[model samples]
Target: MMDLMEESRPDTPLALRGGTRSGDHEKITVNLGFVDLGHVDLLVSEGVYANRSDFIRTAIRNQIERHADITRQSVARNPIEVGLRRYGRAELESARAAGTRLDIRVLGLAVIADDVPADLASAAIASIEVLGSLQASPAVKRVLADRLL
Candidate 1:
């Protein structure tokens, strides 16, 4: 599984998937006003927060927690998976055999296994709406690009 931990670059043909600890984190940059930055700095200096990043993370977590019920309701209504979801070759083949295509909706990482071919992916997947990230071969991504939301 260590071999699947390769980081993805925009220039690379490969995409990322879940395997290592770092796969759980998707780095994001935040912009803040000077006053807010100073406030965060003061909190850090006062030992209320370890750092700006920590403070931001905590704030984000708190907001998410506060809106947990709403999030749950939305997820339930949309039929979306909240975490890591992988669609493998066998699963797609089975769906194809059943004459059913999947409309994948995920709030987190959605992985199409590396072994899944572009044609199979295109045939088996009707549409994809992912709120976070998607992991698939470049070919599969291209074939499904028109169906992605």
Candidate 2:
């Protein structure tokens, strides 16, 4: 794993590159049981939350706060990228040209831009281990299927 403090780059701000949200956050889908859905609706109707998303976000934040220490330790140990990360064709091409390989480890989201080709991705990226989500073209995914974790 990379050292979190040493390898961290402030320039790489986490932003969902191609997501619907205008903010840096990425949109995600979650499935809930009927009872859980009803409870969320109840909370919204009772004015505890403006909407289901508000309640869910709050709940997730609370949970993360509750496990802050563990989360921090894990992040440090794994040295994974915490926000949104996007890789474009030019980036991959440059890596390939420089004979550099990528061992991608992301805790949030990692996206390979649509313009990137499968061969370029395969040549540049050696491995991938994403804890949250990965967004890549089908051909790229298939080419790197063995390297994904």
Candidate 3:
């Protein structure tokens, strides 16, 4: 089974710690048809749901739960890191020293530390394919733009 356990990184700032905090939420914009919006509003008005967001969240959660088996099978089939993956300067430096480049594949959050220089990151990282989010300095992102998927 995939570990649904929460993880913590002592060096990472709370705000940047994705997959490690239950209270953290990623803002997403969705365009809904008028009919759908009206239905959501009606449910909220009847107190079936607290609000539009709440209703949407609940619906999404239900769908995800319903497809949990598919998600687990996919995760198991892929050779990808499942949760938070943080790469610091020291780790990158070591990879560089060994002449090994990293192909980062993450399903949740991938973070290249702020202190990592653009050149250093480029030297150590071969490619990045993140299913969720990637946090890194602007310079590093710019330098590695071609290598991102």
Candidate 4:
């Protein structure tokens, strides 16, 4: 692939999947207050911290580490997936009884179980004779029919 960084503009969004590496650092410039500068200088002079940079770096690092897990989980659990994982054949029946729809997006080709099972899907398709609307692969339709049958 081309260099995404070169193509991306300054307004492009940046997401840290794994919170960045310790060795990979970027340069930044900041203004410091007189009191803060004096405190940093004193800390460096006392050998408690290497310098102001060290203190600031540690604070930024702590913030990143604190929010990394939250970021990863938030990325993983989608609204659609969340609803699907809690639904199945009986749930679909309940939904219909309550006058709700079971409309779905397959996302990709797969035989994995969730939302709608292969057996239920095949039954629905055969009953309605409209598997075309499901937009599922041919092989998957066979699997659904076979399992349901």
**lDDT tens digits by residue: candidate 4, 1-149:** 01101113333332122322232233343445556556767887999877556766777779969998874575477322221122345765565566654444222122223555554554333221221123344554565553331
Question: What would the TM-score be for candidate 1 when compared with the true structure?
Answer: 0.79
Over the stretch 1-149, how does candidate 3's per-residue lDDT look in tens digits? 11111124433211122233333455444555556666877998999998666777789889989999998998889778988899999999999999999999998888899999999999999999999787888899998999988
Give a tens-digit lDDT track for model 2, residues 1-149.
11111113334322212334434455644555556667878998999998776787889899989999998999888788888899999989999999999999987779999999999999999999988777888999999999998
- Preferred candidate (TM-score higher): 2 or 3: 3
| Candidate No. with top lDDT | 1
lDDT for predicted candidate 2 compared with the true structure:
0.78
Q: Give the TM-score of candidate 4.
A: 0.31
Residue 8's lDDT in candidate 2? 31
lDDT of each: 0.80, 0.78, 0.77, 0.44
Model 4 bad stretches (over 4 Å): 1-23, 77-149
| Model 2 residue 147 CA deviation in Å | 1.0
Residue range 79-99, candidate 1, lDDT tens digits:
898889999999999999999
Candidate 2 regions with alpha-carbon error over 4 angstroms: 1-35
Q: Among all windows of ten consecutive residues in candidate 4, which has the lowest summed lDDT?
A: 1-10
- Give TM-scores for every candidate, taking all chains together and pairing residue i with residue i: 0.79, 0.73, 0.78, 0.31
Give residue 102's error in model 2 in angstroms: 0.7
